[model samples]
Target chain A: MKKLINSAESLTADALAGMAAAHPDLRIDPRTHVISRADAPVPGKVGVVSGGGAGHEPLHGGYVGRGMLDAAVVGEVFTSPTPDRILAALRAADSGRGVLQIVKNYTGDTLNFAMAAELAEDLGIAVRTVVVDDDAATGTPDGTPGRSAGRRGTGATVFVERVCGALAEQGADLTAVADAGARVNAATRSIAIALTACTVPAVGRAGFELPDDRIEFGVGIHGEPGLRTEPLRPASEIVQDALAVLLDQLPPGDDDRTIVMVNGLGATPLLELYVVLNEASAVLRKAGLTVAHTLVGNYVTALDMAGVSLTVCRADERTLGLWNTPVNTPALRWGC
Target chain B: MKKLINSAESLTADALAGMAAAHPDLRIDPRTHVISRADAPVPGKVGVVSGGGAGHEPLHGGYVGRGMLDAAVVGEVFTSPTPDRILAALRAADSGRGVLQIVKNYTGDTLNFAMAAELAEDLGIAVRTVVVDDDAATGTPDGTPGRSAGRRGTGATVFVERVCGALAEQGADLTAVADAGARVNAATRSIAIALTACTVPAVGRAGFELPDDRIEFGVGIHGEPGLRTEPLRPASEIVQDALAVLLDQLPPGDDDRTIVMVNGLGATPLLELYVVLNEASAVLRKAGLTVAHTLVGNYVTALDMAGVSLTVCRADERTLGLWNTPVNTPALRWGC
Candidate 1:
């Protein structure tokens, strides 16, 4: 594969070193692979942490800073971090106000974070976990046979981290921070479409090949099979299809205010993301939803996939207030 | 070509609409394709304006906000903005304190922006122009034949816009702002290596292609021919070669502080960019330059090319101060 990397084996470590050099404000643990705030474990404040695979950058690591994640346990590309690494992040982030783990809804990540939470609690550190299952594409309605796994978390992880990070920074207790994260998770929904598959550095090939005239609808972040592959269409039609699925899953009321995030999976240009955002915003407005805050960029991504995910989070005064709170992270920084 | 665009003819307009929707704080003139500050022409503050082809996004448009460019005149992909369109942006950004035009050193961009400056001057608006020529790869020493064109401007335009933007926002006169921009441009050097060619939406194919195991060093943003095609090398070696050229072009003193920007050409992942930055930062430190500020992302891009450019701006205290000034723009926002 034509990638700007030394080798697949050293990809994660090399990137971590680069992160340390690029952001002096962040302290990277070479041994544990935990990226923590340079000034971590703030006394009397709840600590927030999250992590998953490595390819989706600016996600777990880029979000670590003064107002977002206290620590991020990084895994290899498309792989979950081990329980020990998660435990290490938890230990590093605990500041006596306890810690909240924002775990995405993936089998490996969910189990690993849970085990780590238990490990942290055993060490006398109070810990709470919030599972984010906001991807409406993989979700089913209540009482479905496969509904137990729930929706896979996607772009809403950013929303959860931002809002929950604000709450934690405000010296909220672990339970309160966890509750805020869960609340944001519940209010958020996302669906993605992939124009191309991303190649993991180690794989040296695309995860899947797409036909020239076809697009995958409801694709997952890790190239998981989407609901189906459909004939390629115009951007407006593609956007409408994704929006319909999202809105059907989480219908809005007239008075509902929503935060819309048009997230580029990977390799999608900002130009295209803006186009998708324009169409998505228009549809949301036509449906009588007030777009309170808009975030359009590559927040979450597959390594090099050309696609986008539209996320709509139902915002109330409390959620919007927390989102407006100042965040000074590498990826999502504003109002500070 | 696999792209998320409606049509080649409408790509620029669609992207502009998306930019307007994504950033409400910036004003986009549909008629002239000038992206300006919503509140422009601030009395007594010198205005800063820059523009070029539309493909290098977040370059001109994303830089328009409170502390950056007063206006950005956009053209069709890889094509210079018309003289009339550039004149429109100049007029829109003219304040009583006058205006500074930052033009990249591409032939068409330089000529058109210069013509626009002359037109603006005829209309009674003060205009001073700074032509950025910082690409070391395309440079020839003192008295070489054809040296009149100097070097092509590349990634350093971001540095020029930022430093000069701050100076203009601080009420510097047109001469002062233009001087700062020129100084930064002179002190900066950049070199890029491309692994793949980016396709223009209108072209419907890659600009060029290389063998599977070869890379083009010093490739221009518009896919201009580079210095040479070399066998694919590791990231460290690639970075070292690019840095050697940049450093040789603009050597630094023991105590000189510099800002390092690792910019991705459209499709390079952040993970790889950071890895490259990690190596680039180390070589600079070993060479005894103190990296004062680090920017790692796609600031300037070539459509969807998989490559990166490294820009090192040797900064004095004044340049660093200006670089640190608060900027609240769509593409680059911090310390607001």
Candidate 2:
């Protein structure tokens, strides 16, 4: 692989070193793999922490700043952070008011985060958890959402962290912050497709491959096999199908308004992403839905996958108000 | 080439549609390919307008919004916008206050922008221009700074747009705003490298190829060959070389404080970009220069090239203040 890294083993540590050097606002603890705001553990304010594998950048670590996650505990590429690693982030983020853990719905991630939350509680840090399972193609092969392996939380993970972090930064209690996260999770739905598979740093080759004329629909963020493979088509057609799957599962809210994110799966160009975004917004409008907010870029990503993920979250004035709150993370920033 | 596009001919138009759909705050005119703020022509406010070929996204178009470009005119990928298209944007942006055209120093662009400026002047709108030529590799093969063909404007174009755009938004007169852009172009220097060649949609193939163990140093944004080819190395080493070239040519400022941008050329993952950012910061510190501001991502880009570019501009309190001012745009947002 022609990747720009020191070595596979040093990828995470090296990247964290870079993060620490670039963002003095973040406190990067290499020993624990915990990246927290420099002034984290704010007195009397609820703390927010989120993390998972390291490949999907700016997700966990880049989001650790004002108005976003207080701390982001990252593991190696596509590997879940250990329980101890998660525990350290909890310790870093928690103040007297307690902390909330926003975990994705991967099997290892959920299990590890749960264990860490329990450990923090025993240490007198009251910790609450919200697991996001927004990926619509996680449960079964025929496009039915199930809970056996749980829906792999995809793009909406960014939304949960931002909204919940904003609520916490606004001085909401831990329970309330976690509740907000859960509500977002309930209302969000995501669908992903891949033109090419991502290659982990440790492995020098892509996880999978497809003929030039084919694509994997409903792919997971880890480059795992998706619901199925299909012939490649125009971007508009691809986005239309992805949006249909997402709309079918997106929870109903008080209004027919939504926040849309046309996320790039690492290697797709913004040119293509915008093309996808254009089609997605068109789909939403045709379905009688009003798009209240839109984000177009690589927020959460696979290592080097060429694909796009569409995340839609039902929105009301309250949720949008939370989204519009000032945020100063490395990845998502606005309002302030 | 495997790409998520309808066809090569429709690429730019489709992407613009998506851009317009995603950003309702910006009024997108399909006919002129002119994207201006819906509330543009803030009476008596200095109008900031920019345009260029379309492949490098978020460059000219995504930068259109509050405290940035008042309007952006786009042409087909890797092709300069015509005089009339630029004229349309100028008319859309001007409202009593004269318009400033911040352009890249490409032959076609310079010629067209000049023509458009004259056309706008005849139409009763005073027009001023600043042509950015910050790419360090464009001069001589030995890396000497010269004006022959001019240095291909690259990453620092973003810096110029942001700082100058902010100055205009702050009500600076047309000449002052254009001067600010010129000053930034003078102080800024950029160097880029590629691991692979970019594939234009019409071409449907990579412009060039590199062996698994080799790379192109000092590559241009448009997939042009750079200073030379070299064996692939670690991220830190590559960044160190790129920074050395940049520092060699970066103008001496009042102080050693500088603003650094580790820009991804479209397809490079943020993970790798941060690693480059980390190395660049270390190089700056080692050189006894202070990094006052840092921007890391695909702010400027090639369509789907796998590469990175490092840009550094000297920063004083005044420029830092302009940088820190609250600006809202699709690509870069901060300091509200």
Candidate 3:
């Protein structure tokens, strides 16, 4: 394993320290790696918090800011944040309205964030939890949707958290915010493709291996190898393969009420994201799926892995409106 | 050359189609690849616009939302968004309050966005432009601050767009918003390192070669190689090397007014980011440069290349306030 670092075990701590030094907008409790903006615990605003392992860049920590999350708890690479750290973030983010935790559908993350919420509740802070099982490819073997994606939260989690964060920041009740988040999660599904594997710093080397010119379809975000491997095909066909599964899972609707997310698996470039979006739109149009909105970029990524993930969320007027709400974080901002 | 897509030529189009088919909250003008929210041109708000190549994911496009950019224009991989495409986004984003064009330092992006701004002006729409040139290390080989980084905007551009977008959405005049963005660019400086090479789809292989257990310091975002090669070092030492150059160039300050951005070069994970941040902060603190804000993530990537970058911005009260303001995008969001 060839990497540049002082020590593998110390990588996470060292990295967090540098992050604190570099970004002034984020207040880093390096002791816990819980990242909040400089002026956290906004007066009277319900705080929204999310977090998980460290490999996924800008997901948990990068999303800490105004229109989105109030704080983010970061763990080591591919490791879930500890309950203590999460509790710290909750303590910081908790405001008069309440606090909501957006937990991804991962075993570790769910357990830790849920426990932290319980702890917060014990402290008399109103706390709510929403688990995002947005991966359509979860619960299945490696080939079919929900078979082999490995309990993935995929893309809509980012959207869900932002929408929920916006609602909470607007002083919505915890239940209302949690309900909105759950609804959004239920309306979303995702699938991914991988051309290459990522090298975890500690583990040094590609996480997995694929034959040249082969593609692993429906992979998880943490460098878990995908479900099926096949010879490489045109970008259009790849989109079709992923969309065929997604379309079948989505509610049949011509209602122009859906959001599209084309996420790069770590290393895929934006040009490829555009292709994915273009092909995805064409597939949806052919399948009578109406795309009401679109996002193309690296939302959830496997460290340096080369590929893309497609996430589709069925949006109602309310969800769409919430999607337009403002949020402040390191990774995303716009609607508020 | 180990990518999974069948062909490089159709990568962008196919990906866009896939995204459109999957998500409902996002829309793509299939013809133009401009990504917008489901309900664009929101009432009573100025439209914020930004665009560039497709390589940088979740940037201009992912950032298009209510509190951030109103619309994002995407070009081919590592290529500039065409004038026509940018003009389409400008038209889509126009809400009568005027539009702000937040462009990176690249010549291509600057030229294209500038042209689009001109075209919008010709059409009687108010337009403002801010060029981001935050890279410090690659700035001229002759030691000039703005010559060697190939006109790359790097991560600070994200800050420019977000704050400018916020002010624009808040009904700040084009000039005020542009001035704010320009100030951010002026205060910010960035430097990067690369551990390996990235494969551009068109190139179908690593953009450059690096020996095992080696890292190239001062690499450009587009994989333009690096200024120097060194044996791979630990996170602390790596951060030291990068911070050494970056801090040397920054104006001295012991004041509590600095924004630090520790960015992951494509393949580096968040754990490593924190480690890098640790060393960077120590260096900055020793230099009497107090960190008031910070962001650590894959803000500006170089495909799947493994490495990291550092960006430091001296902040004043207004800049700090602006940084804390709300932003809503697919990537970064925060205080609204």
Candidate 4:
């Protein structure tokens, strides 16, 4: 792999060191790989924390700041953080009001975060968990081997974190914050298409190989195999296909409002992400759904895969209010 | 080439449409491809404007807003914008206070922007220009073939835009804003190494081929041939070599403060960029220089090339203060 790293073993640690050095506001523990706000445990405020694999940067760690996440527990690339590490983040972020854990739908991440929540409860801390399963591509109508896994969590995790984080920062109780997160998760859906596969640093090879003339549809964030492979098509067509699937799965009413996010899976250019957003917005507007807000860029990524994901959230008054609330994290900073 | 573009001809327009849709706060002109603040001609503030090829996104367009440039003139990918387009931006951005043009040191960009400034002056709008040439790799000694070209402008353009934009927003006259931009440009130097080649959409192929086990040293932002090719090395060593060249070209005094920016060229991951920043910060500190600030990420990009560039700006009190000033734009928004 032609990566700008020292070695596979030191990738996470080195990146953490860099993150700590770059962001003085974040306090990164060397041992546990937990990144938390420097001034944590804010009195009377519910702590908000999230984590998953490491490759999808600006995700958990980048969201750890004043108006977003209080802490982020990081793991190796495409690997879930250990339960012990998650527990450390919980302990560090607990501020007396309570703590809310935002876990993705990945099996390992779900189980580990659940365990940490249990451990926090064991210590008499009020902890609530919200599992996000927003990926429409992973939806199995019925009887399937991995149907129990549910839809794999994807880019809408940012929406969950942002809305929930804003609510928690506003002194919302743990239950309210958790409910908001669940609400956002339920209203959001995402679908991704990859033009190229990404190589894991440790493995030094791509998880899968894609022919130059073809593209992978509904690819997961971790370079997982998508639903199927098809011949490459124009950006407008690709976006239309993704939108068809997303809208079919989560149809918005005529009076409903929507927030659109066109996320790039690392290596995709912002220029192209905008193209995808342009088409996606047009499609939504033509469908008579009010496109309230739009976000375009590489918010969540799969290492260095060349792909883009379109996420549509059917926002109500409350969800829109929470999303519009000011956030000042590294990745999603605005309205402050 | 695997890219998310509709066609080479429609790339710029499509991306601009997307940018306009994504950032409702910014105004985009479809005719001339000019992205400007929605509320331009800010009565008393001097107008700051910059532009170039379209590939290096979030540069000119993304940096247009409240405290940054009042307008950005976008050209085709890797191609200089026409003089008429530049003039349109200048006219749109100019208030009674006059306009300041921030042009990079490319022959085409310089000539075109200069022509635009001349046209704006004839149209009764006062204009000042700041030409940035901060790339250390293309530097020539006393007697060389292209010594008159000075240096190729690279990542330091962001520093120029930020400092000068802040100054302009403070209601500095055109001359003062131009002077600040020139100072930032004069004090900055950058060097980059590319691990892969980037394919321009129009070309449908990479500018050049790079061997798997080797890297192109001192590569230009436009994929211009570097000084030489060398065997791939560790990130630390690559950073050290680039820093040696940068410092050797623009050495710091004993009591100088510096702002280091580790920029990614398109496809490089933020995780690796921070890895580079980690080492770059260490080297600056060990040199006994005060590292006042650091910006990391893909501020300046070369399509989708996997490479990193290190930019060091030797700053004094005034420049440092200006850097700390709050500016809110699409790409570089913080401290607001």
The CAPRI classification for model 1 reads as: medium
Q: Choose 1 or 2, whichever is better by TM-score.
A: 1
Interface RMSD of each: 1.1, 1.1, 3.7, 1.0
Clashing pairs in 2: A336-B336
- Please tell me which model should have the higher TM-score, number 1 or number 3: 1
**DockQ scores of all models, one per candidate:** 0.75, 0.74, 0.37, 0.76
Score every model by TM-score.
0.97, 0.96, 0.74, 0.98
Candidate 4 local Cα displacement, residue A294, angstroms: 1.6
Root-mean-square deviation (CA) per prediction: 1.6, 1.9, 6.2, 1.7
Off by over 4 Å in 2: A140-147, B140-148
Ranking, DockQ, top scorer first: 4, 1, 2, 3
TM-score of chain B taken alone, every candidate: 0.97, 0.97, 0.91, 0.97
| lDDT tens readout by residue for model 1, A1-336 | 889999999999999999998888888998889999878888888999999989998888999987789999999999999999999999889988889999888999999999998899899999999888888888764413134577888999999999999988888888889889988887888999999889998988988989988989999999988889998887988999898888877734335799999988878878788778878888988877878888887789898888899999999889989888899989888987
Error of 2 at A248 (Å): 2.2
Candidate 4, residues B1-336, lDDT tens digits: the string is: 888888989999999999988898888999999999989978888999999998987787989987789999999999999999999999888988999988888999999999998999999999998888888888853213244677888888999999999998888988899899988887888989999999999999999999888999999889988888998888888888888778877744435689888888888888888889888888877766667788887788898999999999999888888888888998988777
Report lDDT (Cα) of residue A170, candidate 1.
86
lDDT tens string, model 1, B109-146? 99999899899889999999988888888885441312
lDDT of 2 by residue, B92-167 (tens): 9998889999889888999999999999999999999988888887765444656568788888888888988899
